[model samples]
Target: MATTTESNPPAKDSKGLSSLNEFNLEKSILRRGLATAAEIDACKAHKAKLASKDESKGLLEIMVEARVLTKSQSMRLLKEAGEANRRVEIPGYQVIEKLGKGSMGVVYKARQTSVDRIVAVKILLDALAQNKEFIKRFDREAKIAAKLSHNNVVNAIDAGDVNGLHYFVMEYVEGGTIKDVLDKNEVFEEKMAIRIVMAVAEALAHAHQRGLIHRDIKPENVILTKDGNVKLADLGLARLTADEKWAMSEAGMAIGTPYYISPEQVRGQVDVDIRADIYSLGATLYHMVTGQVPYGGETAQEVMRKHVDKNTPFVPPDHLNTKLSSGLGVVVETMMAKNRENRYRNPDDLILDLKCLLQGESPMIAGQKPDDLATLAEGDVEDTSRGISEAQLIEVAGYVNGKQSVIVALAAILALSVITNVVVLATR
Candidate 1:
C-alpha cells in the first residue's frame, strides 16, 4: 500500500542516449537501481551482435536471455517505459513529478489547473485496468476516503476513469509520514507521542462511527504535516463494516503490514472491525515510542505468527522503553491484545483514555487506576482462593488493566459456585 509522500524525483539515467530502446530501458532500469552499467552494456552489445546475424531480439529479451533481468522485471519496466513516454493525459491537471509508486499505481504531484491548487493524483497501472475487481476496489477507496471529513484524514478531492485510466485525486500533504519521523528521531517524546496518537485516534473514531474500518494503520500511513498536524492516509484497505461481500472477497487473506498488523488480521479473520485498527494503532505507537517493532523476525510469517500465536507474549511498550509511563504501556498492551475482545471496543473510549494520559492521568479504560480512585470491582474474581473475600475480588477487578482480567475473575467465581453446589448435593 502507498501514501502520497513525495520522494526524490527519478533522475534521468543514461543521459547520452544511444537509441530510443536503449535509452528507455536504461532509464527504467537505472532509475529503479535494478541493473548496473555493465549489465546494460552487455545487453546492448548482444542486441547489436544479434542484429548483425538477423536474429531479432529486443534489448529486454537479450537481458532476460543473459540473466541480467528477470522476465517479470523486464516486462514491468517495459510497461513503465511505455507509460513514461506517454504523458498521463488526464485533462485539466498538469502533472508535475512522480511522488511514489505502490501496488496499485504511480502517484504524481499534479496541479489542478482550474483551481490552481496542488494535489496528488494516483493513476491506476495499465496492467490492472482491465480487471473489474481492481477498478471497483480502487473506486471503493476513493469513496471511502470521501466519506470521511475529519481534520486528521487525507481528504479525497475526486475520482474517475477517463479513457480506461482510473485516477484518484487527494489533498496533497507536504510533510513526511510517522515513519520518516522515526527515521530522523529514533524515538518521540512521551507527550508528543501521546498527542500524535490522539490525533489519529480521533480520525479513526470518525471512520469507525461511520461504520468504516481502516484495516491498515502502520506508521507509513500516519502522515505528519509541516505544521505538525497528523493525518491518516491510505484508505485502500478500508472497508465498510456492513459490507459482507467485500469481507468475503478478502476473506482468509492477511491484508496489513506484518509489523503492525493486528492478530485477527494476521489470522485472516473475515469479520475484522474497528478493533483491528486500534490494534494496528497500538503497534504503531509502540514503534514511535520505543524505536522498535513489537515483534522481530527474519521473515514476515514468523512475525505474524508471533502476533497470532497465544504462546507468544505481548510485551508492554514500557518493557522495551523503560522511560515510558506505565499508563502508556498499559494502553499499548491493551490495544494490542491478541484477542479482539480485550482491545478497546469503541474508538471514542480509546480517544478518552489517551486524553486522560495526555493530562498526566492514567488511562481509565486501559490502564490501572490510582489506588485512591479504585472503587468497587467490575466483576467477581475467578480463582477459588482459600481466604480472599468478595471485597478483594472487586478490588482486584478495579485494578485490572483490561476486560480479559475481569472475565477471568468472573469465570473463577463461577467455577467456585459449581464446586460448592456439587459438594452440597453429595452431602445430601
Candidate 2:
C-alpha cells in the first residue's frame, strides 16, 4: 500500500508549488474523511494566511497544524480518497483501469466479482446515450455479438444499465489487437499473415450466413490472443441484413474508417452485403503485407473520395513488397476489386481461395465469371459449422451422391484451374 502523503500529494498551482486551499482539501481528503463540517469551515477561513506563509505546505498539512483534522485523520482521508479515485466500482464488477477508448465508448479492464474472471466492460458515453440511433446500435451490437460463438470472434458476456449508464461486458483478451502489432512496424511472414486473415474470413462467413454485416473491418477490431488465435471484435457498426432500420448516416454520408472502406460503403449505400467486409479485409491484408493502404489522402474525405472514383486503380501488394508471392498479389487484388461484382462473390470464395493458398496449392481464381461465381451450390456456401478442411468438404459432399457430386467437385475443379494457371505464371 502506498503512503497517504505519497498517494494524495498537494496539487500544484501556476508556479508548480503547493498552495493550501479549501477546494484542494475537499477533493483530496476532507470530503470523505472523518473531519467535521465545522472543522472544514474553520480551515477555509485561515487557509489563505497559512498558504501565504508557506506556499509549499499542502492543504492536508495546514489542516492538521490548525487542528481542523488530526494528523492521523488527515492520513486516513488521503488513503481513502486515493483508493476511491483508483478504481471505478460498478455493480458486481470492479473496474481496474481504462483498457481502450473509441468513438462509441471506452473499454475498461474489470473483474467480475462473482466469478473472479477478468473481463472487458464498455461504458457508453453520456453524449451517445441520448441519441436513440446510437443507443439502438449499442443494443444491436450486444445482441449480435452475444449470438455469435465463433472462436475467432470476441464473446459478448452480458449487458445492463445502471443509474442511466449503459455498459456491456466481454471476455478479456490479454494479447491486445492487430493494430498494436502494426503500430510497432512489425512484419509478418506470408503464411502467418494469410493464416490470420483466414481466421477473420471464417468469422465473417459465420456472421454473414446469419445475415449480419460488419460494416467496419479493420486491424484495430482484430484482437490477437496469447495462443496465436485471432478474435474479431467491435460490432457497434454491425447491422442485420433483414432488418429495415433507418440508415445510421444520412444521404452522402459515408460510415467506416477511410483506410479500409469499400467502394459501395464509400457511396454511403445502406444495402451493402457481405462483400463490403471482404473489401475491407483485403485492405487490411494490403496493409499487413505492404504497410500502406491502397489509397492515400490527408483527410478521410479525400481518402473516401478516392474510393468512390472508379478511375483510380488499386496498387497490388507486390508493388510495395517485391519479395511477396505473385499468387498472394492476385488474391489481394481479387478481394479489393472496386466493383463489388468483380470481387469475391461471397466469404466462402475468399475463404476457399485463402485455404488453398495456405495449403501450398493454387488459389481458385482463374477464368471464372463473376455471375457464375455468385451462385455457389446450396449447402456449400452457407455452412459455417466448420472450416475448409478435407473432412468438412467430404461431409458437405456427402449431402449429395454419385453424378450430383458435381456440386462438391466444382470446388476441386476451381482449384485445379488455378494450379494450371499458376504453372504458366511460374514458367514466365
* Top-TM-score structure, candidate number: 1
Clashes of 2: 0
Worst-scoring 10-residue span by lDDT in model 2: 13-22
Clashing pairs in 1: 382-409, 382-412, 382-413
RMSD of 2: 14.1
Off by over 4 Å in 2: 1-87, 247-251, 370-428
User: What are the C-alpha RMSDs, in order, of all predicted structures?
Assistant: 12.3, 14.1
Cα deviation in Å at residue 156, candidate 1? 0.5
Taking the tens digit of each residue's C-alpha lDDT, what string does model 2 give over 1-428? 21124466656543233332334436545334557767766765566566677744555666788876788886765554343343344688877555555898878778888998889999887799999888877887899898788999999999988877789999998786778778879866788889999999999999988988888999999988898899999998887776755554433557788999998888888678898999999999998888787899999889988887866777889878997887788899888887676688788888888888788877776224334323344333534454456664575356344335665698899999999999999999
Those runs of model 1 whose alpha carbons end farther than 4 Å from true positions after fitting are 1-85, 368-428
Displacement of residue 184 (Cα, Å) in model 2 is: 2.2
RMSD of 1: 12.3
| lDDT, candidate 2, at 353 | 85
